[model samples]
Target: MNFELDEELINYKEKVRAFALKEFTEEVARTHDIEEKYPNELRMKALHEGIIDFMNPWKTMIGIEEMCRVDPGLGISATVPYFGAEVLMLHGSDYLRENYLAKVISGEKMMGLGVTEPGGGSDVAGLKTVATKNGNEYVVNGSKMFITNGTIADFFVTLVRTSKPDDPAKRHRGLSVMVVERAFEGFSSNKLTGKLGVRATNTGELIFTNMKVPEKNLIGDEGKGFYYIMEFFNISRIFVAAQSIGIAQGVLDRTTDFLKKLEASGEYVGEERKFKLAEIATRVEASRLLMYKAASFLFNYKPNPTITSMAKGYASETASFAAETAMEITGQTGISTDLERFFRDSKIMEIWEGTSEVEKIVISRMILKGEKNE
Candidate 1:
C-alpha cells in the first residue's frame, strides 16, 4: 500500500496552490494583516474563481491547506465564509436545506457557528445564552463570543439553552441549536479588532437582546443540539488539524528558503540547522498522516474522537513548534518578514475549535474509556 494522493487530488491541490500564489500576493497579505482588515475582495474573487468548493469536504480540506500555506490570514478569510453550514446539512430541516443551504453554497450569503459564549471558553454546556420558546417563536437572548465570520455572516447556527434542566448536573440536556438571522430585530454584533493573528478574517461578538428567532429554525431535536454540536466538532477538528498543518508547512517552506540563501552566501550552515529542518519536516508529515487518518474515519461515516483529538491537538502544537523554530532559524530575517505573522497565527490553532488542553482531555478520556481504535 502507498500513501500518495490520487491524480485528482494532486491536480486540485496544484490548482489551488497556483491560484493562491498568483492572487494572494505578499503585498495583499501584509496589508490585510497589518491593517486588520477582512479580505472581502479576495473572498469574492476566490468564490468566483471556484478556488473553494464547500460541497466536497476533501476539496474543502485540501483547499484550506493550500491557501493557508501561502498566507494564513488572507487564506483563512477567503475560505471561512461557509463556517457553519455543516450544522444545517447534518441536522437542519428540509426548509433550511432548501432556503439557507443554497444561498450559502452559492456564496450569496455568509454563515458561522455560535457555540462559544461570553465567559464560556470551551465549556459549551455551560453556555448562558438562552432561547425562550413563545408560541411559534423562540425569543433569543444572551451573547456569543469569538464567533468567526460574525459581523459579516447573514445568519448564524447558534447554540442556546431552551429550558432549565431537571437535574442541576445536566445543563447540557436543555441546550439546543438554532439559526438566527442578522436582520432579526434585537440582533446586533460588535466587531472585535486587534487580533494577534488571522487579522484578515472577521471576528465579532453576537448579541441577541430579546431577538425572536423562528421556531422552525431549530436544528434537530431540542435536547440533542449539544450532541449535534459535539459531532460537528468531531468533524471540524479535522479541518482545524488541516489548517494547523498548513501553517506549519508554510513556515517550513519559508524557513527552508531562508536557509538556502544562507548556504548560498557561504554562511556557516551548521548540522543543527539541518536537523531543525528535518524535525519540522518530519512533524509536518506526521501531522498530515494523523489528519488524513482522522479524516478517513470521519468522512467515511465513522467518527473516531480519540484519533480526531489526537490529530487536532498534535497538529496545532506542531504548528506553533514549526513557526517558533522558523523564527529561531531565520533570526533577524524572520522578524522582518511574514513568518512573524505566521508565528502569531500558529497560536490560535491551539486555542480555537478545541484548545490544546481540551483536545488532550478528549484524547486521554477516550483512551482510558477503552474507546480508542486499534
Candidate 2:
C-alpha cells in the first residue's frame, strides 16, 4: 500500500510548515504562554495567507500537525477560530449557515462549542444545561465550564436539554443543539486563566441565565443533538490525533537535536539515551500512521470509531510519553529549555476532546459489539 502524501498535499504541508516556522517564534510563543493570551493577530494572518483551509480535510490535518510542531499554543490559537464549524456545515439550516457559518469562514467572526458543564468532564450525556421553549424563542439557563474560545467567540454551537427523558436510564434523549450569540442578554463568559497547557488558546466559563435563543437557531431535529455531537467528535478526534502526533514529533526533534549537539561537543551519548530516542521516533511514526488510517476512514464518510479512538488514545499517550522521556534524557537542560513548555503542553492531549480512558471505553465497547472494520 502506498503510504505517501500526494504531490499537492506534500507541497501544502511544506507551505504550512514554512508559515508556522516563520510566524510561531520562540519569543511569541513564550509571551503568549506566559501572558495566557490568545494570538488573534496570528489567526487573522493565517487566514489572510490562506493557511486555514477547511474545504480539504487533508490540508486541515496536515496544517494542524505542522503548526503545532512549531508551537502548540500559538498553532492551536491560529486555527481554533472556527472550532465548531463542523456542526453547522453538517446539520445547521441554510439560514444558520448563511448568517453564522459564512461569517466565520470569511473571518468576520469566531465561534466555539459548548458541551461540557460545571461538573461534567467526560460525561457528555450528563450535562445540566437546560433550554426551555417559550413562544418562538428558547430561554436557556445553565453554565458551561472549560469552553474553548468562550469569551472571544461571537457565537457558540451549544448543547442543552430541551426536555426530560421519559426513561431515566436513557438520559441522552431530548437534547438539542443551537447557536447562542454572545450579544444575547443574560449570556456572559468569564475568561479562565492559568491553564496547564495550550495557554494561548482561550478558555472560559459560559453563564446563561434566561438567555433567549431564536427557534431558527436549532440545528437538525430537536432530539438529535446527542448523535450530532457524537458524529462531530468522530471527526474532531482525528484532528486531536494529528495534534498529538505533532507534539510527539516535536519533542522527538528537540531531543534528537540536543543529543547531536552533545555528541558534536565531544561528549559521548549513552546507549540508554539512544534507545529512548529510537523508541520515541518509533511511537511518533506509529501514531502518524494510525492517525492517517483514522483520517482516511473518517474523511471518506465511513468512520470506524474503534480505529479513531485507538489513534487518538495512543497518540496522546505517545505525546506525553515522548515529552517525559525527552525530559529524562535531557535532564536539567530539557527543564531549562523550551522543551519544558512542550512537556507542559503535551499533557492536555490526554484530557481534551475525549480522554484516554474514554477512548479505551469506546474501543472496548465497539470490539465487544462485533463492529466490523470497514
Candidate 3:
C-alpha cells in the first residue's frame, strides 16, 4: 500500500539521475541517433562507474527509469549490456556462470537474449530455429531477427528447438536454452539500421549455420526453453514498463518546459494545453503505480503475470499518447526538436518485450480465466 521510496532508494534515484544527466548529454544522444550507432563507450562508462548494479534489482529498476527519462536511446544502451543475465543467474550451469556471466558482469564481455526468429515475429512457440544434439555438441541452424546487441554481443542466451513434440498441439514442448558464443564457427550478424526509435541501442540479425554449442552450454533442462523464456519475459516486461513510464515522464518534462517558456515570453497558455498536461501527468502517475505493483509481485518472487501485462500495455500506450500530445502542444517546435526523437523513442516501448496487442491478449485471457489476483 505504500508508494514512497525509502531513504536508500531515494538517494540511489538521485545518483542515477545525476549520472544520466552528466553522461547521456543531449549532444551525445543526438549524435548517436543521427549515426544509428551503439553507445558502447557510454555503456562502458556506466559499467565502470558502478551505475549498473545487477545484484540490486531496485537499483536496476530505478536506474532504468532515471536514465531513460534523460534519453531513451542512451539509457537503454547503457543498461542492457547484460540483457540476459537473469536467465544465466537462474538456470545456467556453474561452468556457464563462471565463464559467461562473470565476464559480462565484469564488463569484459557483452551478451544478449535471442528468442525472436526471423519469421517468428511474436509467435515464440512457433519459432523454427533448431538445435540437433550431436553427441558432445549441438549444431544450431536458423536465424534470429530484431535482436538487441546482435552485432556486438560476445554471446547470446539463445532459444532453439531440440525435438518435435509427441503431441501435435504442444509446439512449445521441445524448446531449449543455450549459450551460443560469437567465436563459434558459422555464426554471423548483420546490423539493422534506420530504426524509428532508440537508435542508440544496437540491433541486428543473427544467423546460425551449423554453429556448434557445447552440450554443457544448455541452460537448466532440455525442452524447457519455452517456459524459461516466458518467465524471463514476465520479469523483463517490468523494465519495459519502467521505460514506458520514463518516456511518458520525459514527454511531460519537455512539454512543461516548452509551455513555461512560451508563457514567460508573453505567449498565451490555453486551458486545452493545461488539460493535456494534466492528463499526461495523471497517466504517468498511474503507470508508475502499476509498474510498482507489478514489480513488487515479480521481484518478490510471487509474480502475477496479469498485472505485469496490464502495466506494460498501459504504460506503453501512455508513452505513445504523451509523445503525440507533446507534439500537438509544442506545435512547430516539435518538428525541429528532441520531441521528435522522443516521439520516435516512445513507439518501440510498445513493440519490444511485447507489443501492446500481445499484452492485451495476456491481460484478457488471464482476466477471463477468473484469475484476477491483481
Candidate 4:
C-alpha cells in the first residue's frame, strides 16, 4: 500500500498552507476570534483562490488540514460554507442541485445544516422539528441550536419530522430532509455569541414558525432523512478527523519551536516536557494515518463506518490531548499565546459532527456486528 501523498496532493497541500499562513494572519485570526465574528472575506477569498475544492475529496481533506493547522477558527470559517453540500450532491433532486447547490458552489450563496435541536444534542432522532405537509409544500416549526453559519446562510438543509412514528420505539422513522430558504416568512435566527471555540465560524439558533418549504426541496425520499444524514455524517467525520489532526500538528509545531528556542537560549528543558512533545507528535501521526485510511475507504465508495468513527474519535481526542499537553509543557507561555486559542478551539472537535462518545458508540456497535477494519 502506498503511504505517501501523490505529488499533486503534496503541492495542493502546500498551496493551501501558504494561503492560510498569508491570509489568516495573527491580527485577522485574533480579530475574528476575540470579536466572535465570521470571516466572510476569507470565505470568499478561499472560494476564489480554489482553496475550498469539494469536487476532489482528497484536496478538500488536505485543504482543511493545512488551513486549520494555521488557525482553526479562520480555517473552519473559510471551508464550512459548503458544509452540508454533500447531502445535496448525493441525494438532492436535479432542481435542487441546479437551483441551490449550483449557487452555493459558485459562491453566490451559503448553506448550513440544521439538525441539532436545543433539546437534542447528539440525539438526532429526538429532534422536535416538525414539517407538516400542506398541499404541495411543508410548513415547518421548531428550532435548531448551535448551527454553523446559522444566521448567515442563504439556505439550510433541515431535518424535520414529517409524520408521527407508528411505534414510539422507532422515533427515527417518518423524518425527512428539506431545503429551507432564509427568506421564508416564518424563518428567523438568533446569533449565538461568547462561544468557547471556533468562534470565527458563525453559530446561531435557527427558528422556524410555520416556515414554508416547497416539496421540491425535499432531499432524496421522505422518511429517509435519517439515513441520508447518517451517510453524510460518515463522510463529514473524515473531514473532522482531518481538522483534528490539523489542530494536533499545529500544537506540535508550536510546542517544538518553543522548546527549541528555550534550549537555544541556554535553558535546561526537562525530560518530562520532551516526553509530552513526543507523545503529541506520535498521536498526531497516528491520527493522520487513521484519517487517511478512513478517507480511502469512504472516497472509494466502500465505506467502513467503524474505521471512520475510530479515526474521528481518536483524532479529536488527540487534538484536545495535544493542546492540553502543550499547555502543560509551555505552562505560562502557553496560556499567554495563540496556543491558548488553540486550546479553546480544540474542545469543539470532540463535540461536533459526532461527539467522541457518540463515535465510540458507533465503533463498538459496528464491531459487534462483525465489521472489521481493513
Candidate 5:
C-alpha cells in the first residue's frame, strides 16, 4: 500500500506544523492545562489558517493528530467544533449548512455535539432526552452530560427522542437530530471542572428545560437520527483514534529525547533501562501502524469497523503506556510540573470518545459479523 501523503496534503501538514510552533508555545500550553481555560484565541487562529476547514477528513484527522502531538487539549479545542459543523454539512438541509457551517469554519461560532445523557453512555437508543413537536417548533427537555465545549458553544447538535417508549423496537426509529442555540429560552450550561485530563478543553452539562427549537433546525429526515448518528460515529471514532495516536507519538518523542539526553550523560543505558525503552518503542510503533490503517480506511471511504476499533483501542492504550514509560524513565522529573501534566492528560485519551472496553466490544462484533458472512 502506498503510504505517502500527496503533495498538497504534505503542504497542509507543514502549514499546521508551522502554525502550532508559532502560536502554541510551551508557556501557552502550560497555562491552558493549569487554568483549565479554553484556547479560544488559538482556535480562531486555526480557523483563519484553514486548519478547521480543511475538507478531507483524513487530512483533518492528520492535522488534528499533529496538533495534539503538541498539546492534546489545544488540539481538541481547535478541532472538535469542526466535527459538529461537519455533521451539519453532511446531513443538514441547505439552510442549516448555509447558516452554521461557515460560521463554525470561521470560528465565529462554536458548536458541540450532544448525545450522551445522564443515564445513557454507549447506548444511543437509550437516550432519555425528549422533544415534543409543536406547530413550527419542537419543545425539548432533558440534559446532556459530559459534552465537550458545552459551556461555551454557540449552538449544539443534539439528539432527542420523539417517539413513545411503549414500542421498544421503535426506540431508535423516532429519534431526531436538531440544533439548539445556547440563547434559546430554558437552555443553559454549567462548566464541569477538575477533570483528570484535557482540562483546557471545556466540558460541561447542558440543560434543556422545555427549550423551543425551530422546525427548520432539524437535521436530515425525521426519525432517521439514529442512523445519521451512527454514520457520524463511524467517522468520528477515526478522528479520536488519530488524536490518541498523536498523543502517543508526542509521549514517545519526549521519552526518546529524554533517553538520548540521559544516554549522553551516561544515565539511561545502565543495562536496566535498555529493555524497558525498547519494549515501549515497539508498542508505540504498533499503535502508530494501527492508527494509520484506520485513517487509510476512512480516506478510502471503506467500511472498516474492525480496523477502526483496533486503531482507537491500541492508540489510546499506547498513549497511556507511553506516558507511563516516560514518567518511569524521567523519574522524579517526569512527575514534577514539567511532565506530569502530559501524563495526567494522556490517561483521559483511553476513557473519552469511547472507553477501551467499548472498543473491544465493537471489534468483537465486527469479527463475529465477518465470520458469519464467511
Candidate 6:
C-alpha cells in the first residue's frame, strides 16, 4: 500500500501545523499544565476553524496527530469536545444532530462518552449503571469515573443496562446507550485532579442519581448499546493510535534536536549516537505507517479489526518506548518538567481507549476466528 499522503492531505496537514503552532503556544501550554485547566478558548478557536468537524475519522485522526505533535494537552483540549458529538453526528437521530452537533461544533455545548465505570475499566459489559424506563423518561442511577471532558460536558452519551439479568445469556445484549443532559435535576459532575498526565483535558466523574432522561435521548435501540459502543471504539481506537503517534513524533523531534546540538558540541563520541538516532527514527516511521493504515481502513468504512488493534497496540507501545529512549538520550535534561510531562502523558495512551492487554486479546481473538474459519 502507498504510504505517502496525497497533495490535498499534505496541504491539510500543513494547515493544521500552522494553526497549532500559532494557537497552542508554549506559555499557554505551561499554564494549562500547571493549573490542570482545560483550554476552553483554544477549543473554541478550533471549533470556529472547522477543525472540530472533520468528520472523516482518518482526517480527524491526522488533525489530532498534528496538533498533539506540538502539545498533547492542547490537542486533547481541541478534540475532547468532539468525542460524544461525533457519535451523534454519525448515528444519532435527526433531532439530536440538529440540536447538538451545531452547538458542539460552536463550543456552546460540550459532550462526553461515559463507558468506563468505577467497577470496571476494560470489562465494559460489567458496567453497573442502570437506566429504567418510566412513563416517558428513563430514570438513570449510576456514577462514571475517569470520563474525559466530564467536568464541562453539557451532556453525556452514557451506557446503561436496561434489561434484567435473566433476559438473555448474551453478556452485552441488555445494555443501552442514552444521552443524559447535565441540566437534569439529578445529574452532576465533579472534577478529578492530580492526574498523571493530559492535565488540560479536565478529567472528571459523572453522577446520575435518578436523572430523568427523555425517551428521545435513547440512541438507536434498547439492548444494542454494546454494539454501538463497539462501533464507536472501532473509530476511537484509531484516534487513540493517532494520539500516541503524535506523542512519539513529538519526542522524536525533541530528541533529534538535542542530539544535533550535542553532536555539534562534540559531547557525544562515536557512531553509537548516530545508530541510536537512526533506530528511533525507524521505529517512529513504522508506528506512523501503522497509524495511517488504521486511518485508511476507517476511511474506507471497512472493519479491519486486526489492523486497528495492531495500530493502537503498536503505536502506544512504540510511543512509550520512544519516550524512554528520549529520556535515555537526553539524560538528566529529559527529566525536566516538559519531557517528564510527555513521559507521563505517553503512559495513559497505552491504557486508555483500551489497555495494551485488551488490545492483545482483541488481536488474538481475531486470529483465532480466522483460523477457525479456515
- Per-residue lDDT of candidate 3, residues 173-223 (tens digit): 999999999999999999999899999999999999999999999999999
Candidate 4 is scored at a TM of 0.99
TM-score of each: 0.98, 0.99, 0.99, 0.99, 0.94, 0.95
Question: In the order shown, what is each candidate's alpha-carbon RMSD?
Answer: 0.9, 0.7, 0.8, 0.7, 2.0, 1.9
Q: Supply candidate 4's per-residue lDDT for 152.
A: 97
In model 4, residue pairs whose N, Cα or C atoms come closer than 3 Å (at least 3 residues apart or on different chains), thus clashing, are none
List pairs with backbone clashes in candidate 6.
Answer: none
Question: Whose TM-score is higher: candidate 4's or candidate 6's?
Answer: 4
- Candidate 2 lDDT over 1-374, as tens digits, reads 99999999999999999999999999999999999999999999999999999889999999999998989998888888888899999999999999999999999999999999989989988999999999999999999999999999999999999999879898899999999999999999999998888999999999999999999999999988999999999988989988888888899989999999999999879999999999999999999999999999999989999999999999999999999999999998999988999999999999999999999999999999999866
Report the poorest 10 consecutive residues by lDDT, candidate 6: 50-59
lDDT of each candidate versus the true structure:
0.91, 0.94, 0.92, 0.95, 0.81, 0.84
How many pairs of residues in model 4 come into backbone collision?
0
Candidate 1 clash figure, as a count: 0
Model 1 Cα lDDT, one tens digit per residue, 114-229: 99988999888999988999999999989999999989999999899998888999888988999999999999999999899999888999999999999999998998888989
- If both were scored by lDDT, which would come out higher, candidate 2 or candidate 3? 2
Give the clash count for each candidate.
Answer: 0, 0, 0, 0, 0, 0
Model 5 stretches astray by more than 4 angstroms: 371-374
For 1-374, candidate 5 gives per-residue lDDT tens digits of: 67677898788888887887788788998899889999888887787778764577767888987888877888878888765665797889889987887777766788889998888887778898999999999999999999999899899999998777557776788898999899999999999999988888999999999999999999989888888887777777778877877777777777777778878987645655667777778887787677777777767767476787788888888878878877887787677644576788788777776789888998898787773211
Model 1, C-alpha of 28: deviation from truth (Å): 0.5
Q: Against the hidden true structure, what lDDT does model 6 obtain? A: 0.84
lDDT of 6 by residue, 1-374 (tens): 57788887788788888899898888898889889999888888887887654555656888989988889888877988878665676678988877876777767888889999998899998898999999998999999999998888888889999986554466787899888888999989999999888898888899989889999988878888898898888888888988988888888888888878887998863577567767778887898887777777667767687788889999989878888888877888789747777787888899988999999999899898883211
